[model samples]
Structure formats: C-alpha cells, structure tokens
Target: MSQTPRYQEIRDDLLARMCDGTYPPGSLLPAEPELAEAYGVSRPTLRQAIQLLADAGYVEKRRRRGTVVRRRKVEQRFMDALMSYGADVEAQGAIPATRVLQARIQGASPEVAEALGIGEGDPVASLMRLRYLDEEPAVLLRTWVPTSVFPGLLGHDFEREGLYDVFAESGLPVETVRRVLEAALPDPVEAELLAIDEGQPCFLFKSVGRAKTGQAVEYSVALYRGDVNTFTVTLTTED
Candidate 1:
C-alpha cells in the first residue's frame, strides 16, 4: 500500500475545517510554526497545503495579516439579467441585508451627471449603503437619481426596500440597465465599509438604469469585495 502524500492529507483536513466553519471566513489561521508543530510536519509541507487552499479560492494571503480564510465567493449573473444585488445574494441561499448609511438630496457630481444624463449640480437623491450576505459585509453601494424623476426617493425606507422595487412601485419601470465593471483597489472609506484590508482588490461596478422612454432614471456605483464575490456574464449567438 502506498502512503498518502503529507500535503494532500493536510489539505483535505483544512478543507474540512473550512466547511464546518472551524476556520470561518476572514479568520486568520494559526502561525506557520504553530501549524507546523501541530501537524508534526515541516513548514514547507504545511505551506503546500496552504497554497492549494489559496489556489482553490478557499483562502487568501493579506499584506499584513497572514493567510485568512475566504468566504465562498457569490457568483453574480449579469448582462443576461437585471438582478438586484439583494436578489442575487438570496439566490445563493444566503440571507441578504442592507445598511443604509446615508440618504438625502444632493447635487449630482460630474461623474453621476454623465451617467444619469442630468446636468451637473442638479438636485439628485443620493443614497449610500453597505450590502451584506450572511452577516458578512460584501459591497458598498452609492446611488443617485434625479429628484425630477423620483421626487420622494429619500422618503422610502431603503433599508428594507430594494431600489428598483421602489422605482417599479412609483409607476416608472426601468426597461434596460447598462453595467460597466472594473477592477480596483479599495479606498480607505470603501475598505472600511466592506470590512476588507486596504490592500485587497475590489470590483467596481457602474450601472445606469433607463425607463422605457430611454430616460435615465438611476445611476449607481458599487465596490464588491473581490475575495468574496465573483461575476458571470453570459453571451449568446442567437438574437
């Protein structure tokens, strides 16, 4: 009988722990020396296991923090469907939650103005929020809609209401949405909001929603934690 490779043994055990939540996401594993001693293996052997886990997206190495267990990445389906962030999270069998940090009427900046096709400094209802899945902060969202479109936009309890749902309720429906995705490192506030290290990379999504008449209704920007989320875009040849 052949003996099992030491690294493979360690790798399987670590994966089991991750499944059982023993080493939950965002939690740091024990120091290398401690882990090596516990497993009665050399640091190199333990590292082989750790590398496998990292390669498989089950863990990540932080700049200052050691190897940290990563959350199961949520796959977001886009382009083919205009799914809300909350809906996409729930589809993964995780509880979706929102924390509305700030909501008010403000003047649209040039960036927002360009996206919404509104004039710069135009009065717009702005909302800032943090999106969570299964109690883990995953995305920071900022949205702006011209007050001319939704006069009472800020009056809704956004903590419990999805933005598009509100638009539909107001007798205006978004018929189309355009999404632009980019990769970037999080800024200080965004890093803090998403509960990720500043050094960690994030996905930046900018979207514009338009009404059936081709009127821009909503402009949103989102920062998604790259470690905890994945995106999917489906293409079809059939028109």
Candidate 2:
C-alpha cells in the first residue's frame, strides 16, 4: 500500500496548478469549504495541505483574503561582499525602498553596548527602518552606533540616503561586518508591519560592523520575511 498521505497528494496537485498558472501569484485560493468539497476531502485535510504550502513559501494566509499565491522570492547575494541592501536588490532588478520609522539618540542595550565596545546605557544613535522590495514590506532593521563616532547621525534624511554611503562620507566606513542568521518567528507588531501572520517564519540577522581601524562602529538587528526572501553565501577553501 502507498504510505503517502491524502493531504500530501492534494498539496502536490495544488503546487502543480500554481506552476501552470491555474493559480497565479497574488490570487486567492477557493474558500476552504468549497475547495474541500471539490477535492473530496475534509476541511481539516484541506487545511493541512494549505498550511504545508504556506510553510514552503508557496502560499500565505492573508487576513480577510484567504490563501494567496506568492510571487517569486527575492534573492539576496550581497552577503559575500557585505554590500548594501539597496545595491543588492537593484542588481537583481527589483525596486528597493526604505522608510525610516525612527531616528534618534538612545541608550544602548546590553547586546548593542557589547557590540559597540561601550558601557551599557551609553548614548547611541538608533535607527529603525522598514525596507521594501517591489513596494512590498521585506525587512526591518534596528541599528545602533556610538554618538562619539557619528554625532550628527540623526540629522541626515535616511529615507533618501544610504547609511553605508553616509558612513564612508563621514570617514568611518564599515570595513567588516560579522553576522549570524537564524530562523525565527516575528512578534505581533512585526507581523503586522510585514503583512504576515505572527506564526510565519522569519530570518533574524544580528551583526556588528567595524571600521578599518578595528573599532566597532555599528551594531544592527534585521528581520527578513522568510516567504518572500532568500539569501546566498559564497564559500571558498582559501585561508
């Protein structure tokens, strides 16, 4: 007897339909009761298949819109050179935009302080930005830099300017960035801003950037939508 579950069979069919344009990107799937009846399966079974699709980046459950097919995922290849997000997205032919949600001086938390080699509670220039790809919310960035290093960091218009360019122009360019990546879930507010469910998966990135003088210059945490984004890293066997 075939051990494959019925839901798995249904999921495969749905995926095939998506590939053939039977269910194009941004289109909503049929209502659960209607689809379940069409497939001769229980609602629970149908949902199981749908949930698998969501987890695999094939579809997403939108509030009041039901399940929606997703467009092609964004491919981010800047990690190898630690390039700016804007440049990377533009290289891939996608429109990039950033909105500065908050830009001000704030006390550095323990993690930020350690990354910046400063005392906890010391003043740091904090910036919270929402990044968009093709006008769709993609990543959230929260950054901290020591005030002594860049006192006028908050005076610039970040929405229209790029941070890397500003840092270089200020004579404190980011020479190196050490980062860590992990899979995680977003908080309620983060979910709303990303237009995704709170239970949806996310990629969390934490990094510390340093100048050529080996001085820590910036620390940041970034959250990326798992369903619509992907990352690539180039590895070599050279010392």
32-128 per-residue lDDT for model 1 (tens digits): 8999999999999999999999998888877667998887788988657977877888878878899999998989999999999989999999999
The CA lDDT of each predicted structure is 0.89, 0.90
TM-score of each: 0.89, 0.79
lDDT of 2 by residue, 144-217 (tens): 98998999999999898888889999988999999989898999999988878888899999988999999998
Clashes (backbone N, CA, C under 3 Å), per candidate, total 0, 0
Winning candidate number (TM-score): 1
